[model samples]
Target chain A: MQQIINFFIKNSTKLLFLLLLVISFGLIIQTHTFHQSSFISSANGVTGYVYENVNNFKEYMHLKTENDALVLENAYLKSIAYNNTSVKDSVEIKNLMPAERQEYSIIVAKVIRNTFNTKENYLTIKGGDKQGIQSDMGVINSNGVIGIIEKTSKNYSTVQSILNVKSKINAKIKGSNHFGTLQWDGKNTGYVNLSDIPRLAEIYKGDTIVTGGISKIFPENIPIGVIEKAYTNETSNYFTISVRLFNDMTNLGYIYVIKNKDIEEINQLEAETKDE
Target chain B: MNSVAFSNIARFIALLIAQILIFNNIDLFGFINPFPYILFIILFPTDNNKPIFYLASFTLGIIVDMFENSGGIHAAASLILAFARPSILKFSFGISYQYHNLNIIKKVTKDIFTSLEVFGYITISVVIHHIVLFGLEFFRFNFIWEILLRTILTTVTTLLTCILILYLIKPSKK
Candidate 1:
């Protein structure tokens, strides 16, 4: 026992270092596997508070650009609203019933913390489960898709940004049924890759890509990006296309969280079908 | 607190602010990021309390990791760097490293050779930190070339910045 105490006293520094290193490694493993390791994440209360203040200060610096974007979006929304009112009046004249009910609702939230310099990037927003946000809800800006909600605390949530290496979204070419998986190559922040596209799909350099909506997370036809380059794979018969995202992901501000109302029903029906 | 403890605390806050607010945002060429925060680990007094030093490094690393949203990679790398610091000092400063109190603001500002030795010490330490950080970040053997390229590029950038900051803080002869 004396010798053991002496040994520990002599090499206490090394032992402390080893212990801390192991803890760090454990943290990395936990975050990578479960992705629910929110205790040490930026969404934690203290860290979230610090990031919120910092981002608020930074947001003030970009208010002009943000205001300009808001103005354009407001104009577009007003035009759509005007057209809808006229259509509704004409439908009343013809004694026609209203169209189908809305299937998705949008929750506006502010990005309080964002990181684009890492391999597995995440964004922290100012809304959480308390604000009707849950994991797997789709997040989008006015321009295009941003990411999906990964985890949530009471007053804040973390988003697994589309720039992350683990991000994979279902996307298809606009005006056609050619669908593929959208993934980041960890090369460029502005671009992502669309793989598993059959070689016969008519793809062009400037074609638009939108969400496939095969899953219940997002509604149909949410815009994703534009194809920058398309080429056939050397080892496989599928075409791998490069898409330049419309949303400048690095400079995100206000974003919308999409909640599909029929998601639970759809999932239950799909599970029942699979059981058979 | 004594002047030593006060100055160390000040250094910690200054480095943390610079790392999180300034260096974290500077993504040069889309890949090169100079982490000057490793200077705190590199310049920490060797004869000081080892356990406290290790703890300080771990806390600094974890805070940086939280800000960047990189889960514990920086903490792991910072601990490794701090653990390896004594040997690095011995190698860079030779037997004379044992004689002089080689604190950067005091003894390192005395001569040209001493300043160069300090630069050498920082270069080695920063390179090791960056290699470990990028290696763990891109944890695949297939990305060995990328890891090497990033390590080299970021090492040069960080080393130059450290030397410049050191000079700005304490202008050495030559």
Candidate 2:
């Protein structure tokens, strides 16, 4: 027993090194597999506070661009409001039906820290559970889709950017019902790849890609990007198309976190179906 | 000794700010981030308490990882480098490193070794750090090419930046 103690004392440094390595590897595995790097994430109070201060100081430089985007979005929203008023007048009685109400809510937020260079990129944005932000909510800008909220702290959240290799959002051609998965290959900041798009669908360069209805997280027909290139190998029945995102993901400021009001019901239904 | 402790603490804070604020934002070629932050592990005084070195390195790495949202890749890589630093020092400096008085940055300032040895030491340290970093990040054999490409490109940038910073902060030859 004394020899064992002596041995441990002799190799304590090596043992400590191995123990720390194990802890770090444990963190890596936990983060990658379960997406639960909560306490260590930048969304925590201290990092969030730091990023917020930096962003507050830096936010002025982006005001011109942010205002322009807001203006464009305002114009679009105004147009929609006008159209909706006309439709409401045409079907005043139909508007009373609870089943036809809007099912998504938008929570406006500003991105404090954004990184697109990493293999698995994440964005730290202002506002979190305090503002009703939650994990799995879809984040978007006036331009297009951004990413899903992966983890949320009380006052901040981290978004899994669409540029992340782990990100796979359900998307489809603007006019077609055929669906594909939009993913990043960790190569280009300007583009992402849309795969699993079957060959039977007539596709062309410049074809617009948008979020499909299949996802409960995002509303159907939310613009994603335009197809820059599409091709297929002889062995495969799918066409892999490259999409050019409208949002210059490298520079982001204001964004909207989408909350699906019917998500609980939809998820419960899906889970029940799976069990059956 | 007190000054050494103070400077080490100051370096820890200064490098963290430089890395998190300045270097992290500089993503050349859309992917390569110059990680001069590892200079902390590299330039930490030799013959210091080993367990304290390990813990300090891990803390620095984990903080960087938290900011970067890269899980524990940085911590793991930094720990490995910290664990292997003695061997690396020995390899670079030879028998001279065994002495308690050896300080790497001070030696560089004193011109005790050729530039080649300095370059070699930094390169080896940076390469090992980045390989484990990008390799664990991608975490797949299929991404071996991507891993290598990122490691090489990032290492060159990091090495250049680290050397520049080293010279910029080297103690005056009194």
Candidate 3:
């Protein structure tokens, strides 16, 4: 016991210095935005590399479930194709509208690192600038909307998950044309809040919410979530609605990146209008 | 309480207030703020327990960090300064350090060193502390030139302020 005390007394400065240094670093990364981002990106690269290997093994283990999903998607696509051809055959009798060319293209990417526990959660994807993935692009899965791209490195990119506190996307009811800002309250992982909705719009529980397409980042009518609950304050004329998200944000795997080809033109036109 | 402990406690409060309220807010040419609070660590009694010294320095640094909203950069830099204080004293004083083993802390305060030696000691400690503080704050290598320039400019300002304070509060030999 005496020996242990003596040793500690002799080298206490070095030990204390190390301990304090670590604590300081933790505080620095937590409080500062720039430091937080740089630390997260570097940490993302290392952790993403490790997760990729682990995900590969997990993917193999869940092969049967993945196969079933793919089969269902194939069946859905076949039925849509058949319906389109049948409609084309009756176009001569009924005045048919011409189909518009698609303005958005999707690039498939795998999530390597995803976090749902924090107030500001982000996901790391395997595709980056090299794969034409840029900042401000929208990310989605087959089921629903995910988030917008935040930053891209050489071979990896980070997406600001809709679960983040700083996230705000334009969303509206399916048929009512009532729009509001969608945001996460950082309480429940499965639910988000839609605020600034007008009290005059008729909204009910289980009403579908989709992207409002007010911004060029996401296309219109992308499924966001379903209304769980809604209320309006006595003093305020807007309703704050609770929405249950369609995506299980915590268990994400594959996602698609949406690139709008007309985004630049749209932005330029908006800028010109604003200048007037 | 003993005079040494009383003086140290008084100095800690005084320095912390000056650092947080005055020095932290003074931004000369946008980035040349001098940190005079480091004088507490520089003049900390050498005969004191090393662990206590480290803890005090870290606490002082954290308090300054909180006021500045700079996270932990100040705490980390001050801890490093405390750890390197002994070597700095040894290098600057040389044989005089061993000669005054009975009261090494007092000896350093009273010794009439040359201006160059005083300048060198202060320069080394201030430069190193600023480098670590700014390096961790920026945490990026792309702005290497900016970091170097800021470190040099801040070190010179801090060194002057510390040296002036040391001279003003010169320790009288008993």
Best by DockQ: 2
Q: What does DockQ give for each predicted structure? A: 0.61, 0.72, 0.17
User: Higher DockQ: candidate 2 or 3?
Assistant: 2
Off by over 4 Å in 3: A1-47, A92-101, A273-276, B1-174
After superposing candidate 1 on the true structure, give the runs of residues whose Cα lies further than 4 Å from its correct spot.
Answer: A1-10, A33-39, A89-101, A263-276, B99-101, B109-114, B171-174
Model 1 score (lDDT):
0.84
lDDT of 1 at B133: 93
**lDDT per residue (tens digit) for residues A131-228 in model 1:** 99988999998888999998787888899999998888999999988889999988789999999989989888889999995867777788989999
Docking class of 3: incorrect
Compared with the true structure, what per-residue lDDT tens digits does model 2 show for residues B1-174? 699888889999999999988898787877788999999998888876999899999999999999998889999999999988888888887867767588666765445235677667778899999999998999989889989999999999998898788778867767
Worst 10 residues of 2 chain A by lDDT: A93-102
Query: Which run of 10 residues does model 2 chain B get worst, by summed lDDT?
Result: B105-114
Candidate 1, residue B146: how far the Cα is off, in Å: 2.9
B132: Cα error in model 2, Å: 1.9
Residue-level lDDT of model 2, residues A17-130, one tens digit each, is: 999999999989887777545457899899999899888988999899889888999999999999999997777765563765769889999999999877788999999999
* Candidate order by decreasing DockQ: 2, 1, 3
Winner of 1 and 2 under DockQ: 2
lDDT of each: 0.84, 0.89, 0.78
Best by lDDT: 2
**Deviation (Å) of A183 in candidate 3:** 0.3
Alpha carbon deviation, residue A232, candidate 2 (Å): 1.9
